[model samples]
Target chain A: MKKKKMIISSQTMELDVVRKVEALSGTSVRRCFQCGKCSAGCPMATFMEHPPNRIVRLLQLGQWQRILAGRSIWYCASCETCSTRCPNKVHLASIMDALRKLSWDAEGPSKESYVQLANRLFLENIRSYGRQYEMRLAAVFNVKSGQFLKDLMLGPKLISKGKLKMFHQKNRNMAEIEKIFSRIEEMRKKGEAL
Target chain B: MDKTLNYAYYPGCSLHASAGEYDLSTRELFNLLGVGLTEVPDWFCCGATPAHNVDELLSLSLCAKNLELAEQVDGDVAVACAACFSRLKFTQHTLLEDETKRRQVEKAIDAPARLDGKVKHLLEILARDIGLERLASAVSKPLSGVKVACYYGCLLTRPPDVPNLDCVEAPTIMERVVEAAGAETVPWSHRMECCGANFTLSRPGVVIQLSNAILDSAKSSGADCVVVACPLCHGNLDMRQKEIEGVYNAEYGLPVFYITQLLAVACGAGAEKSGLGALMVDPFPLLKVKNIL
Candidate 1:
């Protein structure tokens, strides 16, 4: 892992995109003055290349590409510890969400696919069954991620304990749930909602 | 305390399947405590962490839709899962503060976003609505010798002014509720820490490491069991306890009990009624030793 030297200039800086992030998260990236409080409290900071405060600093410098390319935003557990502990009220958790959303919309160059895959399947489960089927979610996640034997040993024990259900009961209001999804899609298409 | 408290129950997705015991214990405990909980009819998922992780509009709309459904039969909306509780409260908070987002969510749901309905986690219901004094009176079998580490995890109280359930930094709702049931709570360090949440499915290695730290903290604190409100926390702590132990090469056989499960058991519900057998780590040994069962 070679360190890429950061070059800050008008060409490299994408302030417009940073503004979009600020708009989406409804928080200012400028407020984070490298306080390091967010990174200190973040549980997943060890797993991230750039910690929460650094992510905000990157956003402030319009270096979101670097933040998104790495696995920092993906590794965030969204524990809201950063948001809760921020002395500057930066709302780092929501900023992480905004970055993830933008990266997802771009079909991201992120190296972390397992987390994105799991999130996709979770949202798909909701849209399809109007609720989450944990058994199906885990099974499909295992299959898609090519980790077929992942959690295989825990399956029988969970079933024996009646923790995992074989069949999920679909919500009776599936039509309404579908409508909500479709309406949101329509709103996004018309640029009526972010 | 004499007044009958009724609420429209939103069990969330986990409650129906993997966290069935939590749902069972909630119903049984609420019944015994005389708190009326009617299931919100055909409630869809509140979009939990995933929806909000990517699409805030979808998350707000999903929770807003559920809030509308909850208005059908309710005093206030009662939520079991901490994630669901957080999302619902967030939707209400966001919609109230930002009129533009509220209008968009209403359009997405094709109904007015109902921000007026009170969204409460089960802890608030037990501690405030039903009152802890009455909870203590209802305990038939006092868990006199059982030591508990009440794990709040995340989402219960964090980021301040959102859930408003208790003090965001140092919440004692779980400890207070468990103590009311005659269980002693240990002053552990990792009670408010994250349990790697949904990563139990995505990045299990992370869950193992984080949950191991939590388990180690509880075990070192001289706790017999870890009590939790969130099902995901329970899963990471209980379902993966053995795996975590193997990964860390340490032994921590602490049983993780949902708050409702422990409360129901203390309130005279049998093992079957409380769904104690659903737990992966055997809690019977501790219960029997404490003479609670």
Candidate 2:
């Protein structure tokens, strides 16, 4: 007798990641009857390849690969209309968020988008400083992403218009901020490895 | 007991820049109200529309860092800007819902703090905590008969729990505040409509269309002016009114104000002192016409 190997398709898995999403959001995912109301109410649903309702369905199946690989999850506006209107109160916005975390682990679509890259650098900068310094974030984002002069023209105009403040007003007890984020990051990595 | 409440405040990029008036007036008003809002020592962009448009988790982590810090404090974190409020609240909602995702966010953020639902907007604190009765008593000069259109915009109330200050759809915080200041808030359709927000840079035409809808709704409803709690709304409705007018071939210079500034004005804090002078489109004339000045 040959030994049997277990395989998981787009359908089967122990992927309770959806459960994690629902638990974290405090919304009842079990009650989602696939009414499509969440998708219908989202303002940015048209721009998404997978609408909020469908995304929730995908999460239920533990189709993590498709979700992490898909770009539609990134397009959610966090408008909360879907969650607001959901009869079952499935927080579609949060599930999309969970998928984004999966994407980070899989190193999926985040590579191509400079905006996403900028966001990482931006958060790291904030993690260090505890507040955002726009001028610095832009400069750092441009240098790292190799778009050194993307919005070069707007610098002087923004400064003159008093729109861009020069320096960050660093928060006191910044180490506390660093510590908090560090804890969350550690927890996230451990969860992903599981 | 003088429990000095403290929290990390994100002025959002716009509040520091285009809507400096909001930054100024909010801080001033908070100071007057005895709430200490220290800028989140060194915060990053909330990733508002940009990151959310590109990567979902990045946006969540971006907001989580701030939300995490807002939770670090005892009192609910107060955001002067509605965009920041919405993003922070949404991130809080997202993080608390999914345990694995929450762990992932915790990993991604890797900060030394923990969060527990303390994020909120200024309007919320004022209405729920401070109470409109107190806000009314603070009013020195009555803004009687000043017909105003209270614009809540999309970010403030849509998610319902994203630091919602009032009812999700037909929010009445602005109205209550206005009425507290002795002003009349007219009902209008485009109250919660998007003012193209940052999309104005990429999709000006869409914003122009939507802004026109908002302005037309207010104007048609006989509003003396539009009062908004968000800086972006003020930008589109007030500063960019000319662009909207050019597209539609009509005149619309409806005064848009930071709700706090209006509160200050109604409370007898002079317009200039309230940073009302900073508004790109002068609302003084409208105030004069409405006899509120």
Candidate 3:
């Protein structure tokens, strides 16, 4: 791993973005005294370039660009282990969500697109059908991610076990669901929500 | 006893589709136990991990709307999926604590956030509401000599305060419920570990690796099979068991059973009623070997 020299100065530090993260996550990055408990208990730490503690450290340093550009936030499974075990009461999992949301809102300079794609398809499924259509979600994910043959063998077995339904029934309250989506969009547009 | 417990059931989206067996067995088990379960009419997704992952407001609003819909039914909500259970509980917890988030969610859903309704997972319904003694009395066919690993996965209990199903690090609810049905619970590691969750879809290699550790722990602990409360856990553990075994060059033919399926079967529900046939890795071999079939 190449260690890049970090130049921390008034011009380089973006505390404004750090404050946005703090407000969004409802957790203070300054509260973390580098206890390393979050990283110690994090299950996805090995898969991430910046572990949970370092993500918080990076946030404290106002290096939001480095954090977002990496795949650490994308790889979080949101298991809440870090939040559960944190001695300082820092909600690392929620912080991960806040970071992901900000990155997602910016259309993400994130190196990890597969996770973003999966999240998009999942939300789209909710909007279109008002529920998840597993068969369609899997099929479309494979097609879009260009992993055409991924999990191909499991498909037949799943269908045979009747686990994968051939068709889906949209929820009866589709109009109500759509209204909620539009109202949230409207709220975001009006600066009423983050 | 206890004024006849009834709940507004929220099976979540997975239960209706890939986790259909969980839905079947929950209804069957509740029926056998003389509990009443009414589905929350027209309830949509609670915006599981993905919704919360990228859009917290949308997640909260979706769950808040579902909570409102659950209000139409006669009793507290009963959630089967662990992910849905966590999201619903987190929404209630957040709405009660954060005024701004609550106001935003209320406006997004076009209704006042309903935070008063209790969202209880099926495990809670069994372990706490129904009582372990009552659960034990209901089990006609005690699963003697069958060692089981009670896999909590991630959502049932975590983050100290949220979910509040049991002690976050050392939960015994699943074990207590299974023990009530006469199965011996094995002590094992990785019970509360994450199974890479939704990454099962986006990055299955992650699921394969993480779930493999869980299965290995269960196998080494002398657990004949693994039992779980969440459908996603079942998917990663059971559906991907063979693939994981192949990848690791191992031979853990452990059949993962849903907590409901195990209890329902012990309470004398037939195989079809318990949806045992739907399991990817066959459970009958172990069930029959233990004379549980």
TM-score of every candidate:
0.97, 0.74, 0.98
Q: Point out the higher-scoring one by DockQ: 1 or 2.
A: 1
Write out the backbone clash pairs for model 3: none
List residue ranges in candidate 2 displaced over 4 A.
A1-31, A54-71, A108-118, A136-161, A172-194, B1-18, B30-77, B86-120, B158-164, B195-216, B235-251
User: What is the lDDT, from 0 to 100, of the residue B82 in candidate 3?
Assistant: 95
How would you encode candidate 1's per-residue C-alpha lDDT over A1-194 as one tens digit per residue? 78999788655667788778878888887778897999899999999999888898888777888988999899999999999998888888889999999999989789999999999999999999999998999899999999999999999999999989999879998999999999989988999877
lDDT of 1 by residue, B37-123 (tens): 999999999999999999998999999999999999858999999999999999999899888888899899888888888999999
Cα deviation at B54, candidate 2, in Å, is 8.7
Per-residue alpha-carbon lDDT of candidate 2 for residues B1-293, written as tens digits (9 for 90 to 100): 21555545767766766678888887776666666777764465676755554345556776777666555446667787887778777677766665555666656766532557577787877787677887788787778878899998778887765565678877788788788888988988878766667544433454577788889999999988888888778877886687678889987778788888888887777776678776656788877876767
Tell me the spans in candidate 1 whose CA falls farther than 4 Å from its real position. Answer: A1-13, B1-3
TM-score of chain A of 2: 0.77
User: DockQ winner among the candidates?
Assistant: 3
Residue-wise lDDT of candidate 3 within A1-194, one digit each (tens)?
Answer: 78999788655667778778878888877788999998998889999999999999888887888999999999999999999888889998999999999999999899999999999999999999999999889999999999999999999989999999989868998999999999999998999888
Q: What is the TM-score of chain A in candidate 1?
A: 0.93
First chain of candidate 3, TM-score: 0.94
Minimal lDDT window, size 10, model 2 chain A: A110-119
Q: What is the lDDT of every predicted structure here?
A: 0.92, 0.69, 0.92
